[model samples]
Each structure stands twice: as structure tokens, then as C-alpha cells.
Target: MFFVDTIELAGLGNRSYLAGGAHTAVAVDPPRDLDQVIAAAVRRGVRISHVVETHIHNDYVSGGLELARVTGAAYLVPAAADVSFERIAVHDGDRVEVDAGLALRAIATPGHTPHHTSYALEEAGAAVAVFTGGSLLLGSVGRPDLVEPRLTERLARAQHTSAHRLAEELPDETAVLPTHGFGSFCSSGQAEGDHTTIGKEKAGNPALVREVDTFVAELLAGLEDVPAYYAHMGPANAVGPARIDLTPPAVADADAIAARLAAGEWVVDLRGRVAFAEGHVAGSFNFEAEGKVATYLAWLIPWGKPVTLLAESPDQLAAAQRELVRVGIDRPAAAAVGGPASWVRDGETPVSFPRATFTDLAKHLGDDVVVLDVRRDSERAGRHIAGSVHIPIHQLHKRLDDVPAGEVWVHCASGMRAAIAASLLDAAGRAVVAIDDPFAAAVEAGLTAVPR
Candidate 1:
């Protein structure tokens, strides 16, 4: 019997897989953090015989090279990927024996990238599962625009063809396990559900159902702003990512924290938004340890800028470190654990801001206040508060001066982003209030107006 184990990189919103027969297994699209994959193999009592990637990932670093090295497994990468490292270059129709009764066959499924490929795991010569890296996802396919603007439409057409080829070639029962959906920005659109098969995709996936031209056109039109940090991920993966170091960084004292802040280094507080709003070091930013730390922080911060982290506990600091490293933030310059009190200089009061709901905003709607919508351009297209200034959070740091001078009330789909914007505003010496409530509440309170 063959068993497949999922390793969810929830922070980055992707999944890796480990599967094989009784003795040996193959790892698919492993994340930079190899401990989880290594531990899963140990528990299953399976030696990792192969570590493979469907493509050079653009969202997070891959641990395939290092994992294969540690386990003495063969590292497999697409033959077309222009990677610097040596590995088992996989090609379409190439099959590798994984165990006595199991084998992996590579299938070219380009679209997510020029070199993207999928692997079908066959048990006793019958295909049981296909790891469709970025090609065929639930209800959606991987976004093709990540590679280059000139090739986006071409890739989209290829994606459509690839999805159909999978459906045509595989059995209806063949499990369709994808790596890039599940809240990943790599997905072309919102993915449908938790699980799906080749049959399910054939029945419902736009890539499979729609004509090539329609699918390509729609996919191109729907592409959103690529995360700023994504420009670095592909190159980093191509060069072969260095093994990550998760050891706790040097502890930053109050003086060091203050100095770093003064020097314009980001001192990020890794606490809940509410805790951060109550009290935080002056000039520090808030990226909650529990939230999408890697996605948001990496998106907003200037690349290569030194960062100092502040967490409420040692564990919180450690957890945040792991999330940041996956996206290639590597080691933090410094980290401090404890409350705002420990981070502030002697005799200096911690900075704080008020948090309210949309109902509160409705009550205070006036010229004296500037309502800021920090959601993405796509989100703001639906509806937003009347007269609210729209500036997506990712662009906020660069466009801070463009915001009208007034007491700012910031909001997003949920409050996490609002809190992040609020902190940025607070750090910039602007009086800000974070709307720590859902956008649906804004609609309930009659505070939203359709965009003109």
C-alpha cells in the first residue's frame, strides 16, 4: 500500500507531499524548512529515495537540494529549468523506480513557468496520483504572469493545454495534488476546495472546460499585483537556496532597538494586533506572529533591509523566524522577547493607537478624519467607504506622503492589514485608528459606497 503525507506550509499557503510504498518514498516540492519533511519520513519508516520539484518556485525557497543531500536521495528537477546546481534532470516520459511496486513518471505541464512539470506516482504500473505542481489546481491554474509579461498570454494558453492533457491522459480516479493553490498568490484565481481529483478538475476547472483563447484571455485579465518580494524568489531558487538557520538571533536591548529604529531598520513586533495596538515601541511596525508574517512583511519591507523582531515570548519569536526564513528573509538582524515595556527606553512611554469598528467610523465620518482603505486594487474595485482614500498596503510605505493629512482611519478585508497600516502611520507620526473589524460589518453599518 502506498501512503501520501502532506506537509502544509500554511504561512506561504502551499503544500508539499511525501509518498511511496512500504520502504522508500519520493518528496514533491518540499519547502525550505526540511525538518517537517524529514520528521514525516522518519515516522513513516521510509527512506527518502527522491526529492523532486515541479518547477523553480517563485514564492518560497525549495529545500529539495538540501533534503536530498541530507538523506542521500537523488535530487530531481525539470530538465528545462536553468538551474546552477547538478541534479537528476527530469524530462517528460522519464520514469524512476521509487520502490519494488512504485514508480514516478514525469509529465511536462508548463504554464506556471517555462520549465514546469508534473509527476505521476504509479503503483504496480497503475497511476494512483499526480503531483500537478502549479499547472492544474482546484477550479484554477497557476498564474502565468510571474515569469515575464511578454510570455504571460503564451503561458496561459499552455496552461489550458496542460490541464486538458492531464485529464486526457490520467484515470478519473487519479488524485490531483497541486502545490500552488490553497491561498497562494501563485494561483490564477481563488481555488475551490480542500481536495479534488482529475475527474473533478475535468468537470469544473476553467482550464479544462474553457477554450484555449478564452482561458488565456481571462487568466491574463485577472492577474493581480505580484508580490514585490517574488522578484527575488525565482533567482534565489535557481542558484540553489542555502540551508536555512533557525537559531534565535542576537537579543536586542532597548537601546539597540531604539538605535535600529532611528537608523530606519524595521523593528517588527510579532504580537497579536490587539496587543500591538495597546502598546508598542515608538517607530516599530507590527506583523503578528500568528498572521501571514512572511507574505505581508516580505511584500512591504524594502528588500535587503536589516530587520529586528520583537515578540511577546521566546516561542513567538522562534515561530516567526521559521515563517520568515521560508520566503528567504533568512536570519533576522536581532530579536527581542517580552512586552512593549521591555522594548522602550528608560522613562519613555510606549506608543499606542485606538482600534475601532466600521460602526465607529460611521459615527465619526467627517472632513476632520481621513478614511484609508489599504486593501488590494481588486478588493477596492468591489466597494469601499465613501470618500475613503485608496492605497494598497504594499504600496503604503512608498506612497505615505500621498495620503491626505488628517486623522487616518485604516481598514482592510479583515483587521490584520489595517493594524499593519495603522502601525506604519503611527510610526510616521500620524494620528491613526485601526478598524479591527470585518468589512461585512461596514456593509451592515451602511458605511460602504460603490466605486464610481
Candidate 2:
């Protein structure tokens, strides 16, 4: 069997596959990291005979259509798949012949997306492996609402019933393989364990172990917040034919980067919001690259326009490149010469971010001080200042409605996220100010903010 996993990092979700037997193989959901999948196939000495889309992915781009086109294989999806494709659409109780005897039987399992499906592989010489995509994960079922919207209840109902159906029908010994693992918004119980058996899932998975109604209710309650970009990826995947260039971009010098910006190109500053807000190339847009870089890259960067990554140091340049490649933006033009800090050595006038140090914030902690905390939920829950209103940096766009219009002040764990949040608010016509260091400011100013 040809086995390949995309090995998505924390918060990065994807599908992986195995091509069992030398004669034919299967590509599961087609990895966004196409090179990894192609390399794995080359090692196994088998051509891909099938490309299976377990479901329409929400977080990242799908490689199924492209992989099948290159391999000359049949692309397969569930009968209910809303995606328009030129390949075979397999349904429940339908059989797809793997080899002369090996078979992949479709099982209708819809929840995360309406068209979602899983397969029970029955091969004469191989151990039974159920390809459970978001149906029965290691410790939970897939979140039901991102793609389907207000019908979270409907999807949860489908998800609850489908998980139970898989648990009851599959053999205890069947090796359960899922598309996404821990840390993915697709699954709430993503961190506890990686992979498990059908029997193990039945025993431990919270969603699968509970009764249908209870499971649905629990799924609704425990649903992790979905990324804003998730709404944009579904329709793009279903229609097929998106222009994602697989090559890394051309590197440009400092002057060339400036020229591109002058020509109206977007600059994505990967440094945290504080670093960016404190000072950045004037007219450059802010999108922090600290965590979930690839995710934000896909969301912020449009197709065809080359990306110029504003890296902190040489250390982050490689990470910046890797994140760009994950979403199929193989090429990035170049990194700023000596970091954004060193750009001034070339005699360029830098834009100063209208920001304050922690001391400045402490001194100004007057009555009606609104400290907007833009860190993630975990960070906010652990410790926060007295007047902080929590709003994670990533969801700043959607959550902007709650911010008070008058003098909205921002500060994250560090200066970075705060700057990004403040920038967005400023763009949206809000009175925004940011603190470069919130913790240090609290201590210096003698404010009664809680400490870690």
C-alpha cells in the first residue's frame, strides 16, 4: 500500500491517504502539500487509480482535482457532493474496485459538510481500514456547522447518526483513519490522541459514545470557533479550477519590493502586530504570521499577485516560505533586506506606528480606559488586565461589531496582535490606540491588572 499523510501542524487541518497494493492506489482528499503525496507515490511504484474527496475542505485548498488530472485516474466523490466534477460520484452501497478483489464501499456520512462521505475498504488480503473523514475521529466527531451555516443542528443530527452508524457497522479491529487530527477546528477533541480503532473510538470518542440527541447537543456546545476564511474556501473547492501556482515566487531586492508596493502590490507583515504597528513600510497591510501562518496567507493573499513577506529575521524566512507553500502559493517574491528595522539603513523614510510603550499605557490608565485584549481565548482566560475586552486577533474582523466606537485601546500578550487588531479597527473607522507591551505597562503604571 502507498501511504501518505500531509502531517498538518497544530491548527492546520487536511486529508491523507494510502494506496494499498502495487497495482493501484488511492489519494485521499489530495494533500495541499502535493509534493509530499507525489514523493510518497514515487516510492511505492504504483499509479494513483482513485482520487477520493472525503468532503469539501473548509480550511485549505484541495489537491484532488489536480492530482487526478496528473495521474489520469478517476476522481470520486460522494453522491451528495455539491461539488461539480467530471469524475465518478459514488454513493452509499456502491462499490469501487481497488484491485480485482479489493473494494472501497461508500458509506454516506454527512455532517462537517453536506457532501461528506467515508469508505469501508474490503480487500481480500489486507486488514479492514475505514476511511472515516470527520465522521468518527479519535476522540470526537467533526464540527457540524462551518459549511452548512445556520443548520448546525441539522448537520449535528447527521453527524451524530453517522458516527453511531460507523461505530455499529465497522468491525472492532478495523483500523480507523480520519482526514483531520487534533488542533484542527474540524474536531474539538483533536489534542488528546492521534489515531485509534473503531472500537476505541466507540469507547472514548465523546460524540460517538453519547446518545444521538445528547451527542448533537454536546457537538453544538463544544464546537470550536471556525476561522473566517472557512466560508470562502467551500464554493471555490466545489466548482473546481482555481489558479494556484505551485512554484515558489521570485525574490526581489529592497528597491524592487518598494516598486511593487508603489505598483499596488500587498505586503503581508508576518511580525506580530506590535512590531508592525510600531513601524512598518507605509501602505503595507498587516497580517500577523506568528501562528497559523499558512491559514492567514490563504485568506489574506489573493490569487496571482506575488507575495512579499516582511520577515523578522533569517530564522523566520524559512517558516514564511513553508507556510506560503502549504496553501499552494509556492513562490514568494523576496524578504525585506535587513528586516523591516534595517530598511532605514538604505535611507528610506519609515512609517512610525502611532503606538505607546507599556509605561505610556500605565500612565494613561485613566477612567473609562478600554483595553482591547486581542489574544486567543486560552490566553485571555488565564490572565487579563482589569479593563480589557477580549477579542482574538484572528477573528478581529467578525468581532469588530462589539468594540466601542470611542477610544478603543488594544494590547495583546505582546505588541504584535494588538497592532494587527488596531490596524483593522482603524481601517474600519474606529478610534484605535495600541500598547506595545501590555504586561510590562500594567506593572510600570501600577495598574491592578492580573498577572500570569
lDDT of each: 0.93, 0.70
User: What is candidate 2's CA lDDT for residue 172?
Assistant: 86
Q: Per-residue alpha-carbon lDDT of model 1 for 1-452, expressed as tens digits?
A: 99999999888889999998889999999998899999999999999999999999999989998999999999999999999999999999999999898999999999999999999999999899999999999899999989998998889988998998899999999999999899899998777778999999889899988888888888888888999999999999999999888999998999999999989899999999999999999999999889899999999999999999999999999899999998989999999998999888899989899999999998899658999999988899898888899999999999999999999999999999999999999999999999999999999999988877
Over 56-89, each residue of candidate 2 has an lDDT whose tens digit, in order, gives 7776667788888878888897777777768788
- For all candidates, the clash counts are 0, 14
Query: Which residue window of length 10 is worst by lDDT in model 1?
Result: 187-196
Candidate 1: pairs in clash: none
User: In candidate 2, where is summed lDDT lowest over 10 consecutive residues?
Assistant: 2-11
RMSD of each: 0.9, 5.3
